[model samples]
Target: MRGLVTFEGGEGAGKTSQIRRLAQRLTEQGETVVLTREPGGSVGAELIRELILGGTGQFDPLAEALLFAAARADHVRKKIKPAIESGSIVLCDRFYDSTKAYQGAGSTVPAGVIAQLTQIAAGDSRPDITFILDIDPKIGIARAGRRNLASSVSADRFEIEGLEFHKRVREGFLAIAAAEPDRCVVIDASRDVDDVASQIWLALEAAKPRFMRNAPQIRLDPKTDALVDDFAQAMKAKLLASQVKYGCSDDWLVDDWEGECQAELANHVQKGDPRDVANYAAFCWGRGWRASPAA
Candidate 1:
């Protein structure tokens, strides 16, 4: 099967250089490779990129996120999926992970909203393997600044974001790697280019066998489980409060209570894995929220 390989990192992580090198190596091995980047993979996406990276105009965080999701949707449809279907390996310099890390983590957008947007943008498609080049944000931004200085090009919006912003981005990448250890390989981008490439190669070698097998299942974190429980309790509390305030009869109570519970569950379901969460939501929706019978 054709594979999708994503290389992700903060600015100055040498993602561009390394991806180019990897593309060459793969091409030399007689594998067809399509190399692309996020925010501008297609023509429409390129327009969105101009708006996002120009720094000339202010855009709300959620608005920017929606723009990213729109671009990604088009890119996946026009470029990535077609390439993979044609037996070509797609090597993306960045992808959805960048959005989650940069826009979701760096901006004021709520994480839940970003998660839902990501699900919609990606649909059923996800990278077969992801290579996250990790480095200190300070070092990375310095490297990027030097490169910009050498090229006599002004810093773009993202490049102009101070070290702290980039630091958050770095942390975001690491968090993603931690969350999806099986799919994400963290490489030390602070090392020499050759060393970084070697690490990537080793990672790919190790991952090849797994890729050939069925897709790996993702495990839920205990924190996520706790969040679910907290949501349920909150729903229960809200329903009880509403019941006391409105003084509704049993029929009205069941209907209104169930509606409120479903709404709360829906909000949480959007952010979390829909497996158990969906089941729980379905159970709650089917069995209307009812108070215990009077003693």
Candidate 2:
């Protein structure tokens, strides 16, 4: 079973502090915990973070979204999957929801694009629970400013955004929590740190057992199901077209079709579920190809 928990909020919402406390608590309970944060989990992602937050270059909103998705793809493949497969409970500071809130909220990028990128990057994985720390933007900005004063370096690009932007970010978090109430639990961050942590712990307790029992599942609406089916059919057609175009069925099997179909199966089928694999193979065979001994 794989479990992921994420903490999200505007600046100065005590997300980092709460994550630390929770990590320690889980450790005490004999759970192997991996504490990580977005846009910095892997080497490639860390480089992207520097480009995003270092204030050195200008990035359009869509470009920024794409960069974020690229980073997430690398992070999930390198760090998140390995840790989860090792049976560690992963506590992430932020995840793709941050991108949706920050880049898709009011920017030029549409929410649909962000959602598609997140799905491709995450490959249907989702956090077991997400904590949204709600707080007044004015208070949060002031607190963040005070905290930044203690650091040696100047404020980064996002940190330099004015109060209005921060206010929008706060509103963005609330909107996200409302939209995904089942996955997101909103905590009043105006309360004391211990009180906020208690709220998060309660939310975790409610979600932990279910998360630890299964891999996270993605539920598709009709539109999304149609889109996925279209993608699969397109891929299949491309393989058949290549076979016809090249007039080489042997090369189709050796170099193209079988590998492509298997990759699709590996991606869409549940891991370690042999029944799904067999079913997928049968479906492919019924479509056209004769099953060989090797297949």
Best by lDDT: 1
Q: Any idea what lDDT model 2 has?
A: 0.75
Worst lDDT 10-window in candidate 1: 209-218
| Per-candidate local distance difference test | 0.77, 0.75
Clashes of each: 0, 0
lDDT of 1 by residue, 1-295 (tens): 2579999999889999999988898788777889888888888888988888887437887888999999999998999888877667889989999988988787778889988998999887799899999999889888999999999987777887877888888888999999999999999999999999988887876665444322223355787977766765665555455546655433324344444444444444445444534444444444444444332
Evaluate model 1: give its TM-score.
Answer: 0.70
Candidate 1: regions farther than 4 A off = 213-295
lDDT of 2 by residue, 130-230 (tens): 99988887888777878888865566776667777777777888889888889999999989999998988888876654562444333447767767566
Q: What TM-scores do the predictions have?
A: 0.70, 0.71
